[model samples]
Target: YTLMSFLFKLMEEGYELDLTYVTERIIAVSFPQDCFEETYLRNLRDVTRMLKSKHTDNYLVINLSERKQELTKMNPKTLDTGWPDFHAPPLDKICSICKAIENWLNADPLHVVVIHCRVRRNLKPPSQQHV
Candidate 1:
């Protein structure tokens, strides 16, 4: 697929806020509706509030999507992996991801870590696994 098509696919239809608690301190969520879009700033604001409500202000983010654009500095401190959708990071990146998370979690009991990707819930359906 062309780069443009891939980007279009990333914007899933019926986009809504869905948060999955992968662990007590780790939450999973979908990308925030093409966050850079000016029209979606309201939605981004809502998302920011929702996220902050789930944890203390001392939270970090692990963004697995290659898209590094954020909510105009309104988001919590984030770590962009520069990893793309529908694929795993290399072994070295995996190791660093783990280390970063571990360090953040260990730093404070209230330090929540939010994880996200381009697709829904950072996962592809079984049918799309091999695409």
Candidate 2:
């Protein structure tokens, strides 16, 4: 949710976005425990669905692990570079993230959604953490 909010804010500000950097920042800030929560997953699905419905042409959904691998293979100096035209005919397909979002959107209308737990595996006690 924090990451999504950041991306949404960046988009609204008309910035030339670097998704790789954005994703990295998000992952860096996220607690591992958050990954297991139902609400966190649902929120992710909701945000993805919204992004897909609104930005179909601009979005690219790849597995997070795969994306990280690809990033590692690139030269550090070229980390800011984006693939605007790397064509492989068979590689054009809807990604799993987008598919999950579509499934959620198709299943029911979304409203009254709330996530109330620490969405991280490494959540320290509240006294030890700062947002």
Clash totals, every prediction: 0, 6
The candidate maximizing lDDT is 1
Tell me the spans in candidate 1 whose CA falls farther than 4 Å from its real position: 1-15, 32-41, 120-131
- The deviation in Å at residue 2 for candidate 1 is 42
* lDDT against the true structure, each candidate: 0.66, 0.34
User: Model 2 over residues 41-128: C-alpha lDDT tens digits?
Assistant: 4434444444445443233333222123322222121122112222222333434334544553355443111111122344555556
For model 1, what is the alpha-carbon lDDT of residue 54? 54
TM-score (C-alpha, index-matched) for candidate 2: 0.26
TM-score of 1: 0.66
* Residue 98 displacement (Å), model 1: 0.8
Candidate 1 residue-wise lDDT, 6-60, digit = tens: 3343355433545566887888766544444653454446556666765648778
Q: TM-scores for all candidates?
A: 0.66, 0.26
